[model samples]
Target: MKKVKHLFLLFALLFSSLLAPVGALTDNSTGASSATSTSQSSVAAIKKRGKIVIGTAADYPPYEFSVKENGVSKRVGIDIDLGKQLAKDLGVKAEFKVMNFDSLLVALETHKVDVVIAAMSPTPERAKSVDFSQVYYGDNQDIVINKADQAKYKTLKDFDGRVIGAQNGSEQYDLAKQQMKGAKLKRLDRVNNLIIALQSHKVDGVVMDSTRAKAFVANNDQLKAINPHFKTSGQQGTAVAVAKDSPGLVAATNQTIAKFKKNNTFDRVYIPRAGKYMSQRARQNTVWNYFVLGVGNTLLITIFAVFFGFLLGLLFALLRWSKNLLFHSIAVAYIEFIRGTPMMVQVMFVYFGIGELIQDIPAVVAGIIAISINSGAYVAEIIRSGVQAVNHGQTEAARSLGMSKQETMRYIIMPQALRNIWPALGNEFITLLKDSSIVSVIGVAELMYQTQLIQSATYKGALPLFIAMVIYFILTFTLTRLLNYGKRKLNRS
Candidate 1:
């Protein structure tokens, strides 16, 4: 009976090994076939996914910005409305992905978004990177100036040698370079930022899309747009951008854009819906209120990241100390790789790169994970050094007293190693807190992100930046004092 059981177990192991590759190959074959099928038609791929993702920078009003309806803030604008229409035409739901305007093209190229429907001009430079649909709207270029200087400017040559501004990567930038000869150009990332620059006299004027300029000037009494605009090199017609691989998607989008234009949807439906949000008047949230919310989120992310990072560091330290070559190599590789790269790149990779595989990872969660993983690598080195600092005699003494290696590690070595490393750990915590600011790029809504939003909304660039700096000082100063107090308490006990 025993011999028969042994033979049966051997057969079972052999059978399982033989089936594993066949199962894996079948899955690979299915995945390859589906990929090929999807590649044939981008329209079919979007419909199969059940939603078409549209990327837009939501800070530009009347083109793409936030509005409150039914007490819920919804993204509304001409471009947003057209995005919904395009998705409907393709028979899929529209899902809007809000991101930095400068990152929109990268988002599309990386498959983070399916198409870009922001008020983006189909410039020749942009066309080289991605395919553009037929024109949906034609907005002219206008120079925005301080209302006080409105009459001081007549034509592009009148502003020669004066300071000018434009949104970075915008046609306005190109226009400013060509028309505003010998002038200093300040290129900002958002239209609102350009308005702030103009209002504060940081820039004498800004060349921007006429529609966007109108929205800003109407909202602020201090600014006005040039009546006779600068002569730009070409038309400023807005269009949709898709990844170059998606020819079918681009064709479908062009068809929808043509239909919308032919039916006068821009006049009948798009204009009416979008115009309501243009001149909204409401009580604005104070800068302090925004700062308070930002501080709370910053602290929450720091605490979660530091705690998990410490735990991971402990695990990594054990792996580094292990006798096995594979474990030590893995620990060393992770530490080197993470420490060698910038946190911003890591944050983007985890959010967009890993997110490409694992669908729907929240930005906040991804940010925290990136921070934790990064801090863990540094902490691991700190711990490994702390352990080595302990005398070898200590381990020998504990083992000679009938303590097993596990017990010796837990009670004898770990306690001493931690005491030696406590100050280093605290310092790591402080560093992690400061480094958390980098996650703002991925829209974590932390202190820096909130401050930028406040600057854009209130048009008080200098004040918001100074206030953010002071707030950060207060946070780091308080944390440093608390850590010192903890260290003193540890010394007493």
Candidate 2:
């Protein structure tokens, strides 16, 4: 029985894994070869519709970007030009959905887009899911390093035991680990973060693309790429992709790439189109490149500031609760003054006041400090109120039981105070979450920055903003509920 159950569990896991790919496959079964077939049988019908929506990972350089010249945020890249020509050849409208690179095929499977022209390199795992067009661009991978290290570095071997940076969840990083023997690799959350680490000399070098490296050097004066490049670069090859089972679209895409290459039409089409963006290579490798990263930086700063402020608040609350008349009066006045004043002014004052003394202190951190101070004031008040709310009898009981006032407060009063104030603490957390979003004014990214990016691109004013608002609502709502549930569970115990 145990053996049968074990076999059942193993089969279930295997079936679940295969189910994702199977669901993504399409079939037009009514036609011939109904017994066993792959590819959409209605390729002819899709062509007749006169539109082919292509999904692309727009983060690649000289490949796709937003340009002021284009007068719109529609993806502009090498693939954009190729897609335009491909659509022209097919006698259909070429549209694009700029999205996360990893999810490109899942989009195709879901019919969210028709094809992928992003710089998708065909790997074995990918080959199983998507049929590939013949290689369009021969692949080129290059290393970027500080200009001072340029002469010493040639092959990746020179960086052996040295920290080299690469973007996480990317082929570039995978290639570096597998191929750059003896080099120590640092994986970063985003490509831009890798650049940040390199610029800060936290990492000795970064492995990326040649074009992007050039772009990074041009944009940032502080960083320069080591010339002569990485030794491991192979054929600058990549291909277009369609759902693997759909052999018709694959055939059509291959025909399109071949026709484009034969006449050199693809190169001509790609160049003028890519030239519109003022080179994204530098920014792509830097931490500030994506709005999402910007949001995270802001949130990190807010968290840091809140943590420090909480410490300060605890100290103030202790002093306020002290029997000393001067300390109590000072605490009361400080609380009253902070609560009465606007928070923005307080943030600006701290930022401008001691900023000169703190060289290299990030503006984000300074803003966080200000926010933490503001949050601490409220925390102090909450703590004081909770302490005062505890029954006088509890303290007296502890004292009668042979405990000192300090011991009684620690063992008896404080715990009850905390239990009573859990609701208030949860409220404080929610307020902090919302208030943190406002730090974007000081150039903190957070949710508001992401929303602004969408608004900047689409100018569809409310739609994108509304979407961000909904995301924030969901996040905050979920956090509040979780905190409340935790408090309830603790109280029950």
Candidate 3:
């Protein structure tokens, strides 16, 4: 259940790598709106692509969150419905891409996603980077504090010197800095993390947008929002952000929002969808459902990573053993570099760093590639050690039987080497399963990721986490026994 966090070290590396990497507008205002004719090419591009990709952060309930309705995890929220409607209006299929809120704007800017509909408030600063549609939902900001501390936080002055939490890169974070004056700010990547800090007493309070505040507080009875709220200069309404100069997409989105508003769609469709989940929370028994989904994905990724890793490892091992100096040197350098650096660094570099050359690589694919690459480096060493352990007499015997060097290695050396390393490779497979959790940082929704979400939503931190621990133990413990059984059989053969 434990993961080597090295949080401070990983964060330092991440911050340096993520700086000024990729490249939004005020709510409703488009930073001098463009004509539809001027943006038709962008609109035409979407139709040609066949799907409208909308990016979102799904941990914010009522606005966006994951839930299991029929033993299947699904992302549902008002913004999801809005994205679907916008896609329908544009006559294209809607495809949702989930990521951290901090990545949404950058994703749009990098063309990794067509638009962002994560209940984002278009701000003047963001307006410079991306274009926004008209407001779909209007909301204010509030500070969430522990219910026990409700009386202690009656006024903004009372919060002076207290640590307040906010979602990094969000309007709430900016508002907290502008309005909270003397309070110390702790910026996090998600609203869920902010709530966790508030509940765990890490932060004295959390400033949140009204919709998310209500959803979070309702689910967490120990939490309460401050009355009279922190003020904003104007409406901090939610809007869809598209690439800069994308007036055609913006025009299509605004049309959908206008139609939805004309028919009171929020009250009719969006509000009710949120209410269903809120009620489900009262009788929630979906822990196993989330775990199952997470485990399936975990195993899928681990298996693929291991399979590809084996092939790559074998290739590198053979290369390292080759007489050719260049091939040996290339293999040596690759193995040492990958094995020496942190896996987290490799994961982030693939996801964010690779954006310089390519765009829109799926997070899951990036995760698989990262883990496989990391595993390949170690597997190469394992194969090399196993090959060297093979008796030299066996190769000589194969060669004496009229076999060439390649045939001798393949028929005589390879089998024995694999037999020697079978147990070691089994252990590597198990380690890869656990290491897959690292992909959660990029929002893969593996077991650890889903467990963290359940912890945030249920607020019964220990229970959900305990359940996750048991599930993980069952999985790993069973797999270990199976591997041992296979090892015994291999030894017998």
Candidate 4:
């Protein structure tokens, strides 16, 4: 119990040190300098910085979507054009940060992006969290259905008792709930996924922006779009969202939007430009080109996570083995907490929650940190079980030889414990490799994210998914063989 208490104390100290920098950086990032700058208005900051970071979910087309330019993926659409124009009006450049649709408002509130221009509606609920510019682009909501079933779902009333799909956190989703009452709603993060669901008959129809619906219908022969004409309180138009209290920035964006409106930029310029990019599809040979990039990032994240996770696991294992009660409790608590929660939530919390404080932390870095922390908890328990499997006599024998606890652990116990836990640790590494896909939600450009990009770019869902599956299989299969080889060598030695 005394040893356990000591271990807990040590773990606490180490954990505190690990977190100290985060707290320090948070303070520094929002310190007096930041306070003083607050007086200068958001517009002044953008002018001084020379760029406005625009957050957007780029999977929705015509409004915003991904297209490859010279073998590199680029976000292009009406919204992108408007963002560029807005930045130009502000005398700065536009820099876009792509993420999930649901995360856009949070990104704005956390100051991760200066503005959100992702075909977003200035709904009353959203206005409470972030300020919105005047309505910039307006369109009727439409329901997209399989061409075969187009006549089956003509109006809103027809969708009642049927399954309807919409992107989560979208105005369409809300409309389905309020107007198409009795319908089973399937909420997905990406519009591409919703379209896939519609095509597969998983959902009877998908509610989406009229322009986006038309774009999808034009690309896919099996799909057709129809207007359900949802009853809305007022004009439901897209707007630029900014952090609350940034009246100067909102006004500036409103001015740019007014110019856009007066000149009919949406119809004359933005739509045609987006359509031109959309018409250009990748050559057949280059369809799987993004897999290489995905593999590189996947390997990078898995390798670094395994290295750091192992160290943390070892530390926590020692803490769990300590006789001190506090140490045992701390280790136990951490292991259970991590094991109980899902990795997806952990990845998001680290990216959005912790990243909120360390505003400059990259999404990839946040993903690695979250994965490492989660892996550490499980690894710690595995190590503890391995150490317990060793005979108690080994410890007594070492102590009788006048060896200190530290030396005994380092030279004697850890070696056997490692051998016993090697397979389990290898399994953990494999699990992490597959689990790394969760970081795609934060736009880490990993395997899954790249696959989504390919899906949006090519408008072919199943093929891109199949390619990603095969690549993942190849990676895991090779890793399994290497792990087996190492195990055999360990047994021989």
Give the lowest summed-lDDT range of ten residues in model 2: 280-289
> How does each model score on TM-score?
0.80, 0.50, 0.80, 0.90
**Candidate 3, which segments miss by more than 4 Å at Cα?**
1-41, 70-72, 174-189, 218-221, 227-235, 261-269, 348-363, 389-403, 442-445, 490-493
Candidate 2 stretches with Cα past 4 Å from truth are 1-42, 48-50, 69-72, 109-111, 188-190, 214-236, 266-269, 279-493
What is candidate 4's lDDT per residue for 38-66, written digit by digit as tens? 43338998898888889999988889988
Top candidate on lDDT is: 4
Ranked by lDDT, top first: 4, 3, 1, 2
Kindly give the stretch of ten consecutive residues in candidate 1 with the minimal lDDT sum. 10-19
Local lDDT at 368 for model 2: 65
User: lDDT at 332 for candidate 1?
Assistant: 85
Clashes of each: 0, 19, 6, 13
Instruction: Point out where model 4 deviates above 4 Å.
Output: 1-41, 282-285, 323-329
Write candidate 3's Cα lDDT for 1-493 as tens digits.
1111222123334333333334212311233333321343287888987788888988777888776666666788899989988888888999998877887886676566889999889898888888889989888777889999988888778999999998888898898889888999999877777777788899999887777778767766898987546766644789999888777788988999999999999978897878688667546665766677688878877887888788779988999999999899878887987899999878867676554234455676668778887898899999999989998888888888899999998878887888899889988988999899888877787888888767645655577778877877887888789988887887787
lDDT at position 437, candidate 1: 83
In Å, residue 211's CA in model 2 sits off its true spot by: 4.1
TM-score attained by model 4: 0.90
> Cα RMSD (Å) between model 4 and the true structure?
5.6
Off by over 4 Å in 1: 1-41, 68-72, 151-161, 177-181, 227-235, 267-275, 281-300, 322-326, 391-393, 402-406, 462-493
